[model samples]
Target: MKAPAISYWSLQLLLGWINFAMTAPMIYLYLGLPLVMRQQGWSGTAIGLFQLAGLPAVLKFVLAAPVDRWARDTAGYRRWSLVLLVGYAASLVALAGLDIGKTGFTTLFALAMLASLFGTWADAPVNALAIRCLPETERMRAGTIRSAASSLGAVFGGGAMLILHDRVGWSWPFFVLGVGLLLALVGLYLIRPVHLDTIATPKRSEVGVRQWVGYFASAQRRRWVVVLMLYFPFIGTAWVYLKPLLLDQGLPSGQVAVVAGLLGGVVGALGSLLGGYVTYRRGLHYALPGFAMLALVALAALSAALASHASLPLLTACTVLLALAMGASAGLVFGMMMYYTREGLTAVDYGLQSSLFVLTRTVVPMLAGLLLDHFGYLGMLSALMAGMLGIGYWSLRFVRGMGEMPPKMGRVA
Candidate 1:
């Protein structure tokens, strides 16, 4: 018998908590740890090497294959999630037991790397379970919730954890996060197992490295991939360099952190939720082109501001516009990722697309940095603006070709 549908908001709440839990330790590793290390007078090289902890995220596609092969049903995915979440939480608790000041940097680094590995590996099954269980109608909202949860995680990991560390010490931050993860694990159990038609019987022969190549084999998927590649990176690059641009414009570092870091994150979260609502109301045909156009305008405005050496007020306005665009675009993009995921191969497909997404997101910033050095802010921003304009036009044409907005959920195009 088909399992009864789970409550939509309850599912989102559980998934959002998982997203938040997975995200926090990563934020701590990337943002919080560096600050503490720097304060401890760690060498620049050592601090730089700490970034290696995130390497596992780049290999998410590889990590996902095992889950796809082994976890053939919603129940199996849930089991994997439970086991992985346990490891993730335990890693944090283990880290809490060690003293950063006394523990060798190597030991601390290894533990953090282990935490990242578990977190990255765990995400695949959690998302696969989400994809399987969530009705097509709720997919966009799932994306919104995921995006918002990630932002809140950033605030907790990057901001609050740092404060906790200062007030109580390093151990407390990890201990607090560890306890939170355990609580999330308990909540995970409260969610009754759901079975969906989308969960296919395991076909061991079809599951392998070829699954990665098969993802892009469809013409419709290829067109969708084009949209995915083009959608977010330009605006993402701009956001990456926004802080330095503000500082160059004479904003104090503290003020810059408030405006760019704190304010930008909060605005991005609200924008994500609002974007999901807009997509729900207007549909993907409208939301896709609408967000692309908004992004184009925001990029143009930011470039013009930079070129003219605009005042802080004008710049701040542009910053808010760009952040909103970024957040909205992120929601739509994430939703589409879920949209494109193949039913039987949920984990591997999502992992492959996500790997591509991360690769471009990472590469663009480096290229943008080069542009910034050679052509300055105006040049870099203008270049991104031009890219967005082209991508935006292409997206409009592509959506027209799709024939309807938000293709019937879970029907393979």
Candidate 2:
């Protein structure tokens, strides 16, 4: 007898948990590390440069082909995820031992990069599994759920961990992260193995680099890719810098962790769920620009607050608004990306798309760091606001034309 169908809600909840687990390590590096480094009296340039530690994320696409190729018989994606998740968790434990003073920053960077790299390896199969499991009808909601889970992960990795680190030291957060990953591993064991035969598994030879690149050769695909690439840079960079901005603005470290990290994360998580609903009702094309415009407004308000050296009440209000808009935008964009991933080349296609997103998410923040040092907080805010406004306008024109292309444009053989 055939197995019973997994309920849509069950799949969402399971995948959401996995996504939350996957993102926690990233939060430690991206959100948690900057604060730690800054407190250690690291310069903006140094903290900004550490963003390169996420280089593995950008390069994960290059490794996707092998990940997709190997481990097919060993429950394929599940096998890969199992090994990598444990390894990543161990790396976090390793981090707990290191001292990240100016002298040991390189050691810390190397280990952090390794942990992130392992996380990326684990992520490749998870993305493939998500594509294989979700029916086209449920893809949008799946994206939203994944985004919400990611926000929660950020709260754990970025917010709560920061609080823990502030109250105690670095070791507690890292140990807790390892423990969390191991717990997630147990959850992964509970899910039924995905049947690869259900997907349109293209023969290995058919899905080549040339064909993969060719997927975006169409005019519409190119335009849509451009929108995905540009959308996150300005606002994303702002979010990356926002914590340090709060610290610089005279907020105590603990308060900054609560206001900018935890509270913002909670608001962002809720917004992601809401954004998913909006995307379901109005379609992602409508949701993208609408969310972008909201973010633009929030960034403008933030710029005004920065000008006045705003009090905690004003700063907290702006941070909350910005997080809400950003979380929603991220959810909508993630949902939009899911629609473009093809059946056979799910890992490669998703990896390529995600690499582009990570490219901007990683690179622009480095520039923002430089801008912060050279231009002061207000100047940096002004620059980001202008860029966000320009991109928001440009996105509406291009995103409207999305999904209008031939059905086969982004698919595998």
Candidate 3:
């Protein structure tokens, strides 16, 4: 009945928010740019190709070994994250100067690609550090706080950027984002000084990729956890299908992007503040089940709204519901995943699961796009619904089963 106390909880939340704030530019810049270019007579396909540039994020697993091995002895992961923040912010400023209007589609896409690559480098250190710092029970609370931080960042970057750029001109988005990242770096520095020995004094055991792959393969009994990871992309892919649906319905692309960003990003961020509370009150067992219900109801409502020619109102409502489902799930599920990982395999387990999450987010969405091409939006939702229901059932069974497993490796990391 005792509450599990976390070390430096407030400081961790601050770091999480700042981390999210610092990293927002990576995706926000591209989210609005497509609509901006569309108005300037740029080909939509040309702008859409920008998605290809972020290929490095999913592949960060390959480079994660280097990140895991190479932090300065003095600062540990914090120093490394700071280094990435500096380089990433610098790339944002460079991106602003790239003559976005005059550059060929290929050239612009390349800059975006490089910027995202820098961001991939940044993301690895953050996640790795989080895995190392907090205990499993604390991860949900941390995730909730972190999700809120990132959600706020997304709102400012995605929602606020759309309106601001249109009225202020293109360069301002880059400028604002650069400043935001700089501030995040400052917040990061305030947490702890870079003292390598203090931060990374643990036993040195190199956990490599093959070992990581084997870990997952060995978790054969935990097959449903991996299955849940594979299913993660459907929701993301389903949402991606939403943008094109809105566009097809004759909504202004910028407005559509702005609305979705506000509802999904800002509202979702707000929703995540309750994530820790929800998990604490309802527990993870019910949290996953609840998200399944939310996703199904919201997606169906959104589908009906789309089919009926309802305007942005219906879209925004559906977006909020989906955002709620995502925020709660994001905060709880990831925390639960961390909870399930035993201490010895902490880094490798995270790396492998993260890779799976990213791979599906990328690949499933791409394949979903092809389906969108043939079946249109409605058919896409039909397919997504079927996949989600099946996966949700399997995931539910797994979560319940794990609760009954004999306690093993229950020590907090």
Candidate whose TM-score is highest: 1
Candidate 1 colliding pairs, count: 0
lDDT against the true structure, per candidate, is: 0.83, 0.77, 0.66
- Alpha-carbon RMSD to native, per candidate: 2.5, 4.1, 4.0
Report the lDDT tens digits of candidate 1 across residue range 172-275. 98888888788778877876654334445555546776778888788888998888887999998999899899999999988887788788888888888999
lDDT of 3 by residue, 1-413 (tens): 22224335755676676657655675575666777778878876777777788787677666556655665232456677788778777877777787656878777777787778777777666665665555445566666777677777777776677778789877888888888778877766665432122234455456676655566564533664565475456666766666667788888977777666666777667667676676567665666666666767777887788789887787777877777766665665555545444344444455556666777777777777778789888888877777778777876776566654312212211
TM-score, per-candidate, Cα-based: 0.93, 0.85, 0.84
lDDT by residue for model 2 over 1-413, one digit each (tens)?
22344655776788788888879879888877897888899889888778778788887777677766664332577778788888899899899887665446688778888898888878878767766766665676777788888889988887778778889987888888888788878876766554334455555544568856876877776877877787767877778788888998989988987887789888988988998887667765667778888888988999899888889999999999988888887886787677665545667777788898888876787788888899887788888878877778877877556544323211210
Q: Evaluate residue 50 in candidate 3 and report its C-alpha lDDT on the 0 to 100 scale.
A: 71
Worst 10 residues of 3 by lDDT: 404-413
lDDT of 3 at 266: 72
On lDDT, the stronger of 2 and 3 is: 2
Candidate 2 Cα errors over 4 Å, as ranges: 1-6, 33-51, 71-75, 96-109, 163-171, 193-200, 206-208, 308-310, 403-413
Among all candidates shown, the one with the greatest lDDT: 1
Question: Candidate 3: deviation at residue 108, Å?
Answer: 3.1
lDDT of 2: 0.77
| Candidate 2 clash figure, as a count | 0
